[model samples]
Target chain A: MKLYDYILSGNCYKIRLFLSFLDINYETVPVDYYPGREHRFPDFLEINPLGQLPVLVDDEVKLRDAQAILIYLASKYDTSGRWYPRNPEAMGKIAMWLSFAGTEIMNSSNARLHDMLAYDLDADKARANAHAAFRILDDHLVEVGFAGQEWIAGTQPSIADVACFPYVALSRDGGIEHDDYPAIQSWLTRIQSLPRFIDMPGIHFMK
Target chain B: MSINFNKYHWFAFYASQQIMPAEIRARSMWNTDIAVWREENGSIHAWKNRCPHRGMRLSYGFIRGSQLVCLYHGWNYEGATAQCSYIPAQPNLKGPKTACVRDFACFEKHGLVWISTVAEAEKEPDFSDFGEAEQTIHFCRSIFVNESPGLVGEILKTSIFIPYGNDLADGAKLKIETSQAEHHQTGANYQAIWQSGRDKKKKTELTCQTEVRNNAILVNHYKDDQGNEGSLIFALLPIDDKKTGVHVLFSGDFSSQSLTSAKRHYAKWAKRMRWSIENRNLQTDSFNPWI
Candidate 1:
């Protein structure tokens, strides 16, 4: 297996983090997603039409999109069936969060791109939307915790947790403060405490 | 004005069990970053989190058995001395002594791990009261407060009143007998007494002592009523200038059932105190003179 990864990209980090949790060894092909813009070149576009990062190639299977790759890896590799459960209710809940990760979280990640990579965008509006999304997620997490559930989907941590983790954890890069969201901070801590968990550049281990 | 690091000569940074993981953990004290880790042999160490080479965070490094290896350059540091034992880039050459990571004086006692920035500090803080009843020590969940340690100390001096076990006999009353505050070079110390019941014929005594040592607070509780004796220790660690972490250690001669009740009561009390401290508008002038 080979992962086209960019260390600074939170979307790429999501797949890398999940692979680490699964203890699966795969070669990383570093993509210069910054000033170089290698992902847009013809060679990379052949692998991914969307010109996005974190394309995973396993034998005959080539998967795009971090969320899709997370589902595929958890479905095929996780013997415990906990990461991507087959139960319909669990899958529905997980799917909703996955879509939330792609839509609501991508707005926050775009702000990070503007700040860190100097990408031109309306950062203030992106940040405001990010905060709105975070408020909803934080309130949802508080309710879930009251129900004695720690993760986003079902009783155990599923791909839903992996999907939404990176952008939320790295929201500070976009000038988003998580100080007001105690539940989100606690959720970040719980994710860090998972066995075989790995951190990206901005996300450090919470003591 | 910069903080006097020596004021934290002997401070409790974390509970001993907190460093149980074999991987390196990160902690901050007075704005100084520290990398804490426990080796396979169960020995704990605290070092400056910055690697001597290129200033990479050592907490981001990995532990290879007992040696901590920096993730950036693979500089291996031995556990006890924090001396660079091997540099993978130069495997054949012996790593220079000066290449070692700076270490702090660390010692574990009474269920807490302490770190001192000053090297010549001869001994750890005298937690002898808690040490005397080692077998009964029970640690409560730590509380983190987003407030200055000094402000938290002031609040504790004036507003903190932890209740004794709820299982006290019927018609029993716990009243504060004496409250005394003293100032020391580092911080302040408060001592208080609580007398149970109005009847002088059958009286019970509860004594509480709190030591505010710079960025940390050490609390000791003692109860002597009808041949029942107990002790509890609460240690606070300053995570940074404005954030504080608190840990509780309870020791006493009480039945298991009573101990459970005491633990639950103190845990809730600690949470409430933390919430109050974090939410209160703390003014420097409002601090007690002694504190």
Candidate 2:
């Protein structure tokens, strides 16, 4: 599998983390996204006309969108039921949450982070959206305690936790403080303590 | 040669969407013009959708015991393969293929009946994805002429599938039964038939144009000029739907505090897919017809 990225993308980092956890072997194809670079080239369009990050290529299969790749890997390789699990009820529980990450967090939170990193920080709107998202989590953590006793989906650390971890884990870099939600904070600590956990790949890995 | 994918190529097709249910093609099981019927025993038999002697669609035909008698001709067809069992003048010729109309290929799964698009067929269609925990909804099928299945997989953001099963276990369950674990056999309960064909005038198969609106992508699976099938179905895993949280430990939304200028490209891909489908070859790498 070939992973295309700019190195610092937290979205890309998510792929790397899962790959490391499963120990699935793959090759990384780094795409240059600087002014008028790899994205606009004819070759890239042939690969993914949509032109997005973290494209996982396995022979004839090319996965461009992050969320799709996350599902593909988890569904394809996980036999342990520890990562991507099976069972109808557990399946529904996981599906609804993953959808939330796409429809909500990525659009509201990650979009703001991407904008801020681009240098035009809409601090006020970003801050408001951040708080709005936080409130939802605050209530949720209260509904279901945040202790490491059980991972996001009740028992195991699943793609649900993987899907939500990165952006929120690095929210501080984008100027959103993490002090407000103690439950969320403790949950973060628990995730960090996992056995095969790896650090978020930083900007320098691009070269 | 123009590939019609209709009666000429595929006689029938079936898809067992991982997150969805198995589907059947009941439209083409006609004998001349009469439709087929099954007895209470779950046996499937076909006939002309219409009676040859008069012309009433067999869909309107009545089933008594194991026989399907056309309401118009009062003609009786064989209960098993739907051969004409009785014709006022042809009683002696009884239930033979010569006295029959059309008998299409019918296959079954789970608890449903499936007709084929072709005569000579081999290999069960790939459906390993149904066992995967991922979300796969076979809503409206749109075929881009000659587009590869893997390419189709890449286009999907939240839902997709690869043609090869190399990425997944051949069977649904993975068990360690012996030292040679590779030889251990496992299983997944897959059903091809389930007595669930909804009756409607609009052809069940359709096609439509998809677009990117606001920031969300909308795929409209409405009908087109040619007769086809289309509809929108979303298959995704569960996650928190709430958009806001009260604090850090409580949420995971990213915030940008840095003054450094960051450029984020806003992209929403939208395109209209045509819905002229002929043979839905379960074994196809290209969902489109092959000329």
Candidate 3:
């Protein structure tokens, strides 16, 4: 499988973490985002007319969307509640959160940042947007921590952890702090110790 | 099911569309006083759990065409009026078409039956392809941050970063270079990248211009514009480590292709930056605690 990827994006990081955790081997295809031409190129468009990065084109099919990609991988791979499990109730729980991740974290965190960062709004709104997501997670963390256990869903780590691994860790990039969140802190400690654990991609200090 | 209050009162919850099969028929929570059932021919009827005169849970009643007769009383209730008919005690009296407990709305689809109190229905909720195609295989896990629905939608709309930790995992004390929000004019587009154990924003002068393909989704955020609240869209894209790598494109083109990629590509991307996601579960990860 070849991945059209950007190092700094957290959305793409979700998938990257899962692959490494599962021990899957693949090559990363770098799109020349700097020149801005590669993405619009006909060849690249042919693979994914959507023009999204982290486009995974493999022998069987071509796919896009981090959440969708995560679903496909966890489903195809056989794991006893390892990455993707087969239980009905358990599946629902995981689905609910994954949906939340796609809608809530992905949108509010970055949108708030864009409001300030892109000059759409003032700094207050950007921080407010970041805080909005923070409160949502803090409320959820009051109890039933990590699906009632060390992992996100079920008894062990699954794609749920992989899918959410990035934004959960590095929200501070948008100036959202994590010191106030104790359960979040605890949860972070647990996931950080994973065997194939990796750090976040750095910010563009000198764009 | 139908609910009965005092004085022959009638109450029904829209069960489904009134065309559901027997298997998914009882997904209604209509007060639980009466049982709703479908006759063999496909018409619906509500009967008391007991014979109108007797007291059986009409749900156990048998369906004979449009009329439902109590199993024990053998007293039939007409579907048209929900009125009692052919009562053994009052054999000669004709029953009203409304003698039977009437069937209401409610059915199963979007995972469960969603019933409304008002009669006559409007359009159903648009369950997007996003809802149908994706499945969260892991556990409920936790909420990352306390984000509102609209704001979260915006984040999704803007950009999704896959934290690629190839070097960072190896203990690279990569100084999280910081910068201020450029606050550019003309709807400026940019990506905010964060480093682990580091909290600061950095500005980088782009050496080149490029396209950042974004996700098709639009975040639905509501804010007070004037005296009223309004909505705006936050578009998103998925970025990979290879091109936008912590090792490489710390500053690079953000695109929509990142939002739409194969599962393998996303999985690979997830693999690269997972340590961070796991570590940074947001503050709003939870929902309705202490329930």
**TM value for model 3:** 0.39
A139 in model 2: Cα distance from truth in Å? 2.6
lDDT of 3 by residue, B163-280 (tens): 3221122222222112422222112232333233332232122111112122112322221212211222212111111111011112112243422222223233323332333333
- Candidate 1 per-residue lDDT, tens place, B31-97, comes to 7888778887778899999998889888777777788888899999999778989988899989898
Task: Point to the candidate with the largest TM-score.
Answer: 1
Q: Supply the global lDDT for candidate 2.
A: 0.44
Q: How close is chain B to the truth by TM-score, in each candidate?
A: 0.74, 0.37, 0.33
Question: What lDDT would each prediction earn against the true structure?
Answer: 0.72, 0.44, 0.45
lDDT of 1: 0.72
The DockQ values of the predictions, listed in order, are 0.08, 0.01, 0.01
The better-scoring model by DockQ among 1 and 2 is 1
At residue A188, candidate 2 shows an lDDT of 60
Interface RMSD of every candidate? 7.4, 20.7, 15.9
How do all the candidates rank in terms of lDDT, highest first? 1, 3, 2
Model 1, residue B56: C-alpha shift (Å): 2.0
